[model samples]
Target: MDRTGKSDSGSSSMTTMGMVFVKAQNTPLYSKAWTPSTTGGYASTCIFLLILAITSRMLLAYRTRLERSWHDKAINRRYIMISGQTEADRERQAVGKGGEKTEVAVLTANGTDERVKVVRSAGRNLEGKPWRFSTDLPRAALFTVDSGVKYLLMLAVMTMNVGYFFSVLAGLFVGELAIGRYTGAGEGHH
Candidate 1:
């Protein structure tokens, strides 16, 4: 007890009740509290976060690379090919009977099967000529970075890990706030 010739105050400093006191200093509450369970839990959390973060990063990178490669290929191709919208255009063009030129065919998004009816110069204004020819695409969706859509999707999909981190932080913050609020509420009751 030394200096006081009685006892140390720090050991009894946690709280006071007139002459009585409750000590919390040097408590075992958290001191050297390492344990197998705690270690395992920490390891598991680390592994999970690492896996999720890395996978999210890699998947986004791979998809972005793939998309870029596709756009590059499309750019290299000089021919304009419509897809998904071509067939419909062809059908609409052919509606003018056995003769006549069909106009305004639906452009398909797919380039492989662009069909344009050849109109013959007879019943229709024109004949034996394709109602529509898929025109050269000035640019593709993936190539133009300014499309605004792919970029947003890429941003969101690429940063899933960040979102998860935010979620964790939000949970922790909320928990602390709630605890603080409850503690304050109890104090007010006195």
Candidate 2:
């Protein structure tokens, strides 16, 4: 009666919205008649995508935290003060160089002055004089490669930017979005 010129209730039908049954083969279009289950398909997809977005964001945050903790343990430290002597003086009291490399005569991390050999060269050479730096292990170590630790904290911000941008994009295109910032990214706080 509506479109095929027959009784409206006279066809093999499928239940749609409002419990109305319509002939699946003869339904003109679905936009006006899609069911709850059909709409829920898209909703469920969105929920799953949201869950995925959140999980990935948390995982990335955990990864960065672990990495930072490891880095902190590496550079947070103590220091040592060593005496200096001539390059050619082997038996002389070379606080840090070529003299009596005393272990207890300097301020240090373990509180014992241990002479550690540090080699710095112009570059790796085939046959150059090996310049060695002998000093008491200093307890003072810079938190970051830079003298200031704020530089190291930039890692946290950069990580946030990458994760945030991707999450926003996912929300817009994939129906998902989740992002989080870390403590290290705090204002003048790291």
The candidate maximizing TM-score is 2
Residue-wise C-alpha lDDT for candidate 1, range 1-190, written one tens digit per residue: 5554445654642432343222322211112452124544544443444444334333334445554454444334332333354555667645645543444334456643334333333322322323222222322432343334333333323333343244334433443444433332233110
Return the TM-score for each candidate structure: 0.24, 0.29
Best by lDDT: 1
The 10 consecutive residues of candidate 1 with the worst lDDT sum are: 22-31
lDDT of each: 0.38, 0.36
Q: Write the per-residue lDDT of candidate 2 for residues 1-190, one digit (tens) a residue.
A: 5554455787654443443333222221223342224544534433443445444445444545654564444333222433454435423433433222333343456764344322222222323332323211121232222223233223222333333234334543332123356423532221
